[model samples]
Target: MSAHRLPGSGPLMVFGGPYSNLEATRALRALATAKGIAPENCICTGDLVAYCARPNDTLAQIREWGCTAIMGNCEESLVAQAIDCGCGFEAGSACDALSIDWYRFASARVTAEEREWVAQLPRQLGFQWNGLDIHVTHGAPSKTNRFLFASSKASSKREELDSTPAHVMLAGHCGIPFGETFDRENGDQGYWLNSGAIGMPANDGTADGWYLLLEPLAERVRASWHRLHYDAHSEQRSMIAEGLDNGYARALTSGLWPSMDVLPAAEREQRGIALQPPALMIEPNH
Candidate 1:
């Protein structure tokens, strides 16, 4: 319930699930610098460490970037020294089985000091842009490990949105970029936006991650999804070197996940098809 207000203006670059991919994290940092987006205006929706090599390096890089970040399920589990990632995958599912090795690898590599830093991260962040109140969380506002995807029911999404006073909820966890506007009974609209993940591709048959750019436009906010290109082969090599050649190692290049245990039917049907989520113009709340 620790929520901090982000102070800034102009465009905000929000991304999620760095997932311990150092190369992808570096590419994002470079992209932010190139766009002249200061660290204060940049927000990460968490999971800074997860399924990949170089967990400690990725943590260090994010700290050095100095962006505003919130606690993800991975951080929460690591701080508590949990035996699993706490990603909410089914107990006997493929995702749960695969998580065992990577979680252990990440837990061992992350230093005690790094865990301390993650423990202090807020559970949520809030900001105002062009008269719109925006709230950011690792997953749904109701649960840190909840998986809300593009195919989620509108009513379910609305319930989560109603739990907060903000006009927009920025979230990550399902590892896909999507946005939708929900109309409340009173006629005001709320937005659900996921910037996607920087550490892993969107299972779109290409080795590229995703991020979101939110820019102020008069009384509205323009939300655009962008692809993050990085050295996927190098990351694969690193994973192999670390003896972490789980299915994720190949996913780095294949742009496909090792398991679809967490994906909905609609999302599973869209696998391997490049995602073209339309840019949304977030209207001010009525």
Candidate 2:
């Protein structure tokens, strides 16, 4: 649970779930590099490999670039040699079945050294920015695979925030970008942010994935969600070529999950609708 401190005054780029899409990974890194966002300032919420082709290549890109990343549930499962993806899908569910195909493919492809590297990854990361204590995780602080969607109740987010001393909690694994602020006694406030995934679409009927940028202004910190555009056709073609022709492969183009099994009812209702993540401006305590 040790934290990785990011030093510098530049905007911090946050993203997650590379999910083994090498094309998207490369594009994202290229954009980050072009923006002069140093590798240290870019944080990945993990799942470097998942339901896509080219697991080895995708992980290689991440390692070569040397960004700050925490261990996601996929890494935990792979490192433990678990039989499944550790996504917490129920038994006999379509997600579970679909996971079996890709998990086996990824597990077989990743090297022993890579598994060791994944095992060594910290489960969470922390740093201080603009007078706020920021913590990052692949999922909720309490659980690696816990799904905290935008529609999750306010009380749930409050309890999650109360579990830690973080002023802001940034996480992934839910595959959607959102920002929420909770009220506390004496006018104190806490924040939860999901940067979404760069490797897959937000089920928003678009081929674009998402990332987040945190820019510290003079009076407040600005958190903005951005859509990452890459060649979804190329990614889909690769998956099809590799026989990964499953839900995730098609999800790249359709922007719809093959199954609603993992999503809450509210999120299920949002399938195929375009996502417009709101920008949040947070003021420092006076």
Q: Candidate 1, residues 1-286: lDDT per residue as tens digits?
A: 1224364777999899999999999999999999999887888999999999999899888888888899899999999999999999999999999999999999998899999989999988776767888888888888999999988997888888888878899999989999988886567888999999999999888899999999988777899999999999999999999999889999999999999999999999999999878999998765
Hey, what RMSD does candidate 1 come out at? 1.8
The segments of candidate 1 whose C-alpha lies over 4 angstroms from its true place after superposition are 1-5
CA-lDDT, candidates in order = 0.90, 0.88
Residue 61 shift from truth in candidate 1, angstroms: 0.8
Error of 2 at 264 (Å): 1.5
> Model 1: what TM-score?
0.97
lDDT per residue for candidate 2 within 94-207, as digits (tens), equals: 989999999999999999998987788889877777877788888888899999998999777777777776778889999988999988544688889999999989988898
What's each prediction's TM-score? 0.97, 0.96
Lowest lDDT sum, 10 consecutive residues, model 2, at 1-10
